[model samples]
Target: MKVYNTNQIKNFTLLGNTGSGKTTLAEAMLFEGKVIERRGEVENKNTVSDYSDIERENGSSVYATVLYAEINDKKLNFIDPSGSDDFINGVAAALSVTDIGVLVINAQNGIEVGTEIHSRYLEKAKKGAVIVVNQLDHEKASFDKVIEDATERLGKNVTIIQYPLNEGTSFDSFIDVLLMKKYCYAGGKLEISEVPADQKDRAEELRAELIEKAAENDEGLMEIFFDKGSLTEDEMRRGITVGLIQRGIIPVVCVSAKKNYGVGRMMEFFTRVFPSPNDVPPPVDTVSGNPVKCDAASPASAFIFKSAIEQHLGEVNYFKVMSGEITEGMDVVNNKTGNKDRISQLFAVAGKNRTKVPKLTAGDIGQTVKLKSARTGQTLAAPGNNVVFAKIDFPEPKFRTAIKAVNESDEEKLNEALQRLYMEDPTICVEYSKELKQTIISGQGEYHLNIVKWHLDNIFKIAAEYITPKIPYRETITRIAQADYRHKKQSGGAGQFGEVHMVIEPYAEGMPDPAMYKINGKEFKISVRDKEEYDMPWGGKLVYYNSIVGGSIDARFMPAILKGIMEKMEEGPLTGSYARDIRVTVYDGKMHPVDSNEISFRLAGRNAFREAFKNAGPKIMEPIYNVEVWVPADRMGDVMSDLQTRRAVVQGMSSEKGFEKITARVPLAEMNRYSTALSSITGGRAMYSMKFAEYAQVPGDIQTKLIEVFAAEEKDE
Candidate 1:
C-alpha cells in the first residue's frame, strides 16, 4: 500500500440502524474501488465488513470493521460499526477516529431508534454527515417519505443531493442535483446523461437550493452565487466541500447497495465532496489542551483508539496518527503507561486483509502488532512530543448482572478472560463488589453482555452463567440508645476482663457535638476528653468520642475498641449490611489492668454497640439512582407506569429530539434487568442511562422482608 498524506486521505464511519445495509454498502464501496473482485452480500454471510464468526452468526456486525479503499487517487478509510444499541461501543470507537459519519438510512423506515441515536452522537461530536438512503430497490422503499422524515428529525441541514427516479423493486436510477445529471443503471451498469425533460425542472430547483445552501458556508461562494444566480461545477464542489467540513450541509444521496446502483457515483461524491483529513479539525492533546495538527514534519504521535485479539495475529492495536507520522520499527513511549514500545509491523487493514505499509502519515488509521503493554485510549508519542489525544467518551453501561463460573473452579479463569474482553471493548465493564460479594459484569444492554458470555463460552472455552446481582444496601440508626456490656474470660493462668458503656445516636451533618443525654428520664452529664472522627468508606461518618476521664480505661486499648465498632459497622448488626451515619460515645468504661487486652476491649465494645444499635430504631437503606429514560411518545405512559411499580420518584418529563425523556429516582434493587424490560415494553425503541443519586431508607415492608431474608441466609449458613 502507498503512503498517503493527510490531505489525500478521507476517513468516514458507516453508521445506521441494523437493517440499514451498512455492511452491504461497505461491500459495494470496496468492490467499486477494485479492492475486491466481486461484491459480497450480508445475507450470504460473506460481506467484507461482517467477517467475524460472531457477526456471521448474528448476520450483523459485532465489532467495528476498519477497512480502506483507494478511489480516484485518494485513500478512503471506512469504519463500519455495529448498529444495534447493544454494541454501541463499536460506534463510539469508530466515531473517535473518523471525520465524517455516512449514515445509511433504510428507505422503508426513515427515522429509527438507531438513526436518532447515531445522529445525536454525530451532533455531539460536531462532525459532518453524508446521509445515504439505501435499499432503494426494496419493495417498500419510499424516497419522498424518507426526505420528509429526515427533515423533521435531522433538521434542515439535510439537503438533497440525489433523488431516486424510480424507487421500488425496479429502482435503477437517480438524478444528481449537484452535477445536474441523471444516473441510470441497466443490468447493473451505470449510464450518466442529461436530465430528461420530465425531470429537468425538479432537478433545477433542487440544484438551486443545493447551491444556495453550499454558498452560505463561504463568503466568496456567496458573492459568486448572488452575482451569477447560480454556481459552476467547480464552484459548487468547492462550496460543498466547505459546507461539509463546517457541517453546514448534510447532503442526502440514494443507492441500491444490493444492485450496485449509483454506488460508484456515491463514491465519487465522497472523494470530491467530503472533507479530507486536513480539512477536519485535528484531535486535541489532553495533556496540553492544544490541537495536534496534521503535520508530518512534527514530532511523531499516535493515539490507539481500539485494540483487539485477532485469530492468528495475537493482539492487534489500531491507531490514528494524530501528528507527524508512524513508521514501522519506530520506537515510541506510551504516554499513558510510560512504557516504551517498538512498532515492529504496521499495515493498512481492510477487515481481515492487511497490506504492509512502510509508513502512515498524520490523520491516517492503521493497525500494528506486538506492542508491549499498549492498550486502547493510550497515546504513543515521540520522547519529546509526549502528546496524548483526548479519549473517546463512551456511554455508561445500562445493564448489569453478576457473572459466576458454572464450574466453581473456573472462577479465576473467568475473571482473566473477562479482563481480556474489557481490554478489547471498554464498554464491557467488570468489577467485583466487595459489599455484595459478587463479580458483576455490565454493558450497554443485556444482549451486549450475552455476547461477552458467548465469547467466553466459545473462544475462551470457559463455562460461566449470570446470576442475579445483589444490591449494596446500608444500615443506619434513627434514635439514641445506651447500653453496657462486660467481657470476662477466666483461665487457669490469666484472665480477660473489660467493661464498656456506650451511647449510640444517628449522626447528621451540621449537628452539635456530645453535650448531654436524657435517656428514660435519666440525665447523664458527659465530658468529652478526646474526640476522633472517621469518614467511613461506605458513605457516611463514624465519630468516636472517648469520654474516659482520668484515664479510667487506658488510651492504648482505644484503637481496639474502635476496631470492634468498625467491624460491626462493616457488617451491620441487623442485616449484615454496612452501617453509616452513627456516632459512638464511650462515656464510661471499666477495665482490669492485669487481664485487660485489645481482644477483651474489642469484644466488650462490639457487644455494647450491637445492643445499643438494636434498641436505637435501626433501619435499612437502599441505593437510589438518578435515571433518565428516553422513549417514543407513544410508549411514555407505559414506561412511567412501569417505573411507578419500581417505586420511582418522577423528577421531570421533557421532549428531546423526537423522543420523550423521563427523569426519575429509583432504588437499585428495583432496577435490576431494567434495560431488558424497557426494550420489551418499548419494542427496543427506548434508551436510558442511570447514575448514583443517594441512599435513602427502605420502606418499612421492604425492610422487614430484607431482614427476614438475611436471617434465613444466616440460619442456612
Candidate 2:
C-alpha cells in the first residue's frame, strides 16, 4: 500500500437497497481501472466486496469491504457496504468515514426503503451525493421512471452527466454530456467516438443543461456563459469540480454493471469530478463535553469504531485516525478507560483480508490487532493526549433470547464467546440474571442475533442453543401493615436469641421513591410514601437518618437488624422480583451482650423483612418499551389494530417507507416475541425499533396470573 497526500484521495461509500447492484458496480469499476482482469459476478459469489461465506450463501453483503482504484493519477477509496436493512450499521460506519456517498438504485426497482434510509443519513452527514441509476441492461429497467423517482425522492440538484445510447438489450454505450462524446463497449472493450448524427441534437440539449448547471458554481464561468452563452472545455471542467464539492449540482451516470457497460466513463467521472480529502474539511470532535481539532501532523489519535474477531486473529479493531499517525509498536492510551496499551500490528483491511501497513495517517481507517481493553467507541491516543473522541450512539436492541451451551459442559466457552462478540459488536448485549438463572443475549433483531450465534458456532467453534428470553418482573408493597419475628434457638452449648419488630408500608405508584421500614426491639414503625416530594425521615439515625434516640436499640446489634431487612429486599414481598428504593430504621432494640452475635441478628433481620413484606400490600411491576414501527401506508390499519390488541398507546405517526411510521408505548411483557408477530402482520415488509420506556404497574388480572405462575415456578425450582 502507498500513502497518498490527502489532496490526491477521493473516498466514497456505495449504498442502496439489496439487489441494487452496488457490488457489481464496484467490480465494474475495478475492471475498468485495470485493477482486476475481469469483472466478477455477484451470482457467482466472486465479487470483491461481498466476500464473506455468509454473504456468499445469502447473496447479499453483510459487512463493509474496502478497496481502491487509481485513475488519472488520483486514488479513489471505495467502501462497499451491505444493503440489507439488518446490517445497516455497517452502512452507517462506512458513511461516517467517506468524503462523499454515491447512492445506487436499480432502474427496475426505483426508490426503495434502503434508498430512503441511507439518503437521510447522507443528508445529515452533509456530504456531496450522486445517484447512480444501475441495471440499464435489464429488460425491465426504466431510466426515465428511475430518474423521476430519484428527482422526486432525492432532490432537484440531480443532473444527468451521462445518458445511455440504447435501452434494455441495446444498452451497450453512453453519451458523456459534459464532454460531448460517446463511449461504447464492443466485445468488452471501450471505444471512444464522435456523437452519432441521429442523436446529436438530443445530446447537445443535455450537454447544454450540464454546462449551465456547472457554470452556476463558478463566477468566471457564470459570466462567460451569461455574456457569450457558451462554456469552453477548460471552464466546464473547472466549474464541474467546484459544483460537485459545493453540491450545487450532482452528476448522474447510467451504467449496466452486470455487463460492464459505461464503467470506464464512470471511473473517469469519479476521478475528475469527486472532491478529494483536502477539498473537503476534516472531521471535528462534536462530543459536546470535549472537542478536539483533528490534526494530521500531530501524535496519533484514533477512535475504535468497529471490531471483529477472526478465527485465527484473536481480535481486530477498526479505528479512524483523527490526528497525527499510527504505527506498529507505539504505545497508545485509551481515553475512555485511561489505560495504556501497545499497538501490536496495524493493518488496513479489505473485508476479511488483512494487508499490513507501516503507518496510517490522519483521515485514514486502519485496524490494530489484540488490544486487550479497547472496544467499540473507545478512543486511543498518544500517551500524553487526553482527548476522548465523539462516540457513535447505536440503536437499541429489538430482540432478546436466553442462550445456553448445547452440551452444558461448554459453559465457560459460551461465556468467552459471548464476551468476545460483545466487544466486537456493542449493539449486541449479554447478561446473566440470577433470578431467572439464564444467560440472555440481545440484538437489533432476530436476524442480527442469529447471525451472531452463527459466527460463534462456525468461526469461534462455540455451539449454543438459544431460547426466547424472559421479561424482567418486579414486586413491591401496595399497603401498610406491621409484623414481628423472634429468633430464639436453645442448643446444648449456646442459644441464639434475637427479636425484630417492624412496620411495612406500600410505595406509591408512578414514583421511584424509597420506603421506610422502622423497627424497635419490641415494634417496628414504617412510613411509605411516593417519591414526588423530598420528605426525608428525621430524629432516627440509621442508614440515611439523622438523630438516634437514647440507645433504644443497642448499637452492637443494629447491624444484624439491618441485615435481615436487606435480605428481604432481594426476596420480593409479592411476586418475588427484587424490591427497591426503601429506607429501613432501627429505632429501638434489645441486645444480650453475650448471645446477640452478628449471625443471630442477621437471621432475625431476615425474618423481620419477610414478615414486614407479607404485612405490607405487595404488588407486581411490569416493564414498558417505547416503540416505533415503519410500515407501508396500506398496512397502517393492520398495525394500528394490532397495537390496540397489545394494549399499546399510540404516541404519534410520521411518514416513512412510502408508508406511515407509528410511534407508541407498549408493555415489554406483550412484546416478548413481537418481531415475529410484527413480521407476520405486515407480511415481513414492515420494520420496528424499540427501547426501554419505564416500569408500570401490572394490570390486576394479569398480575394475578403472574403471581400464580411465579409461585408455581418457584415451588418447582
Candidate 3:
C-alpha cells in the first residue's frame, strides 16, 4: 500500500435517498479504480458497501462502508453510508470526518424526501457537495427535468458539468462541458469522440454558464472572462477547483452506476476538482477549546467515528487521523473514557477487507482492532496533548420497545448483548425503566429496532421478544381528604398495636410556607414548615408534615411512617402507578409502648395513606410529548386530521421550504408506533420528532380503561 499526505487525500461521503444507487456507485468507482475485479449488485448481496447480513437481507445498506482507491497518485477515501433515514446516524458520523459530500440522486425519481433531508444535513455541516444523477439508463430517466428540480431544491449554486447525450434506453454517451468532448461507452471501453452537432449548441451554452460561475470564485478570473470572452483550460480548471472547495459551485454529473457509464469520468473529476483534507478548516478541540489544524508535526490526535463488532475480530474501530500521524504501537489516551490504549495494528479498510499499514497520516481514514476502551465518537490523542474532539451528534431515538428475554434465565445474556450492540451503534439506546419494571430499547424507527432484534437473536443467540412499552403514568390527588387507620396484631410474642390519623391534599406549587400551625389541639410553632416539602427525585413533590403532639408517637418512628407512606406512593392505591405532588400530614396517632415498634407505625401509616388516597380525588396523568411533524404541503390536512384523532392538541402550524411543519402535544400512549403511522399516511414522505413535554391528565374514558386493564392483569398474576 502507498501512503499519501493530507494534500493527496480526498475524503468524501456518498449520501442520497435509499434507492438512489449510492452503493452501486461506490462499487462502480472501486471497479474503475481497479481496487476490485468486478462490480457487485445489491440484489445479489455481493456489493462491497452492503456486505452486512442485515443489509443484504433487507436489500439496502444498513452500515457505513469505508472504501478507498488511488487515482493519479492521489488517495480517494469514500464513506458509503446507508441512505435510509433509519440509519442516518451513519451518514452523520461519516460527514463529521469527510471533506466533501457526494449526493447521488436517482434520475427517474428526481428529488425525494430523503434528498431534502440529506441536503439539510449538508448545509448544517457546511460541507461542499457534488450532485451525481445516477440511473440514467432507467426507462423513465429524464436528465433535463431532474436537473431543473435539483437546481430548485438545492439552490442556484448547482451547475451542470456533464449530461447524458441520449438518456433512458439509449444512454451510452455523455458530453463533458468542461472538456468540450464526448465520452461514449463501447464494448466495455470508453472512447473519446467529438461532440455531436445536434447537442453542440446546448453543450456550449452550459459551458458558458459554468465558466461564468467558476469566474465568480476569483476577481482576477472574472476580469479575464470579461476582457478575453473566455478563460484558458488551465485557468478554468483552477477557478472551478476553488469554487468547489468553497461550495460556491455544486457541479452536477451524470452516471449509470450499474452499467459503469461515465463513472470513470466522475472519478477523474473527484481527484482534480474536490477539495483535499488540507483545504478544509480544522475542527475545534473540546478540551482545549481551540481549533486543531491538520498538521502531521503537531501532537497526534485521531477520532473514532464508527465501530463494528465482528465474530472473530472482536471490535474494529474505524477512525480518521485528525492531526499528526497514527502508527502501530503508538500509546494514546481516550479523552472521553480517560483510558489509555495502545494501537497494536493499523489497517486501511475496504469494506470488511483490510490491509495492514505501517502508519496512517493526518486526514486519512483507517481502522485498528481490539482497543480496550475506545468507542465511537471518542478522541484518541497523544498522552501530553490532552485534546478531545467534539462528539458526533446523532439524532435521538424516536421509537421505543420493551425487550424481554424469551427465557428468564437469559436475561443477563440479553442485557450483555444489548450493551455490545449499543456500543457498535450509538444511536441505539438501552434503558432500564424502574417505574415500568421493563428493559426498554429505543432506536430511529421500526426498521432500526428490527435490526437490533435480529442481531440479538442471531448474533448473540439470545432469543428475545419486543412489545409496546408501558407508559409511566403517574397518580396524583386533586382534592383534600382525611382518614384514620389502626393496625393491631397479636402474634403471642409481642402484640403490635398502632393507630394513625392523617389529612391528605393536593400539593400546590408553593405549599408548606414557614409559619405557625396548630395540630392535635396544640399551638405548635412550626418554624421550618417549608422544609417539609421534599422534591421527589422522579419529579413533582412529596410534602410530609409531622403534626403529632404530646409525644403521641416518638420522633424516631416518624421516618418509618414516612417510609411507609413513600412505599404506598410508589405503588399507588389506584392502578398501582407512582404517585406524585401530594401532601400527607400525620396529625395524630396512638401507640402501645411494648408493641409500638417501627414496623407497627410503618404498617399503620401505610394503611392510613392508602385509605386517604382512595377518598381523595385521584387522577391518572399520562406522559405527553411535543411532536413536530414535517410533511408535504398537500398532506398537511390529512396529518392534522390524523393528529386530532389521537387526542393531540395542535399548538401551531407553519410552512418551511416545501413542507408543512405541524407542532402538537400528544399523549405518549397515543403515539405508539406513530412514526410508522405517519409514514403510512403520507406514503413515506413525512418525518416527525418528539420529546417529553409534561404529564397531562388522561381522558376519563381512557383512564377508566387503563385501570380496568391493570386490575385484570393483576388478577391474572
lDDT of every model, 2 decimals: 0.90, 0.74, 0.88
lDDT digits (tens) for residues 1-717 of candidate 2: 676555566778998887899999988877665567766788999887788787898787877777667677776777887776667677667666677788898888887767776776777777778888899988888888887878776667778878887768777888887788888886777898889998799889988888898899989899999999989777777787787677777778888888878776788778777776556656655544544444567777888867776667767788877778888899999988989899988876655556687887776677888897888778899998777766675667788889998888899988988887777667778989886679988876677788887887787787788986777776666665555567777777787777665554554435432334433433333333211222322111123221124553466666566656666666675666766544443333455656767777788778876876776666777778999888878888998999998989999999842658999999987777677788788866677889887777788999889889878988999
Residue 601, candidate 3: alpha-carbon lDDT: 86
Candidate 1 local distance difference test against the native = 0.90
lDDT of 3 at 516: 50
TM-scores of all candidate predictions against the true structure: 0.97, 0.85, 0.92
In model 1, which runs have C-alpha deviations exceeding 4 angstroms? none
TM-score of structure candidate 1: 0.97
By lDDT, rank the candidates, best first.
1, 3, 2
Identify the leading candidate in terms of TM-score. 1
Of 1 and 2, which scores higher on TM-score? 1
Residue pair clashes in candidate 1 = none
lDDT of 3 by residue, 1-717 (tens): 877898899999999998999999999988887789988999899988888888898898999899988788888999999887888889899999998889999999988788878888888898888999999999999998888888877778899999898899778889999998999986668999888899899999999999998899988999999999998767777787788777888999999999999998999988988878877779999877899999878889999999889767988899999999999999999988889999999998889767899999999999999899788999999998888888898987888889999899999999999999998889999999998999988888998888998898778899999977999999998877777889999878888988887778888885644245443464434333213667777788898888777778788888888988999999987788889999877777898878888898899999999988988889999999999998998888899999999999999988875778999999988888888888899998888888999988898889899889999989999
Candidate 3 residue spans exceeding 4 A from truth? 217-247, 484-491, 495-502, 508-533, 545-555, 584-597
Off by over 4 Å in 2: 192-251, 285-296, 311-314, 317-319, 326-349, 352-360, 366-387, 490-493, 506-551, 555-559, 581-601
Which of candidates 2 and 3 is the stronger one according to TM-score? 3
RMSD after Cα superposition, model 1: 1.6
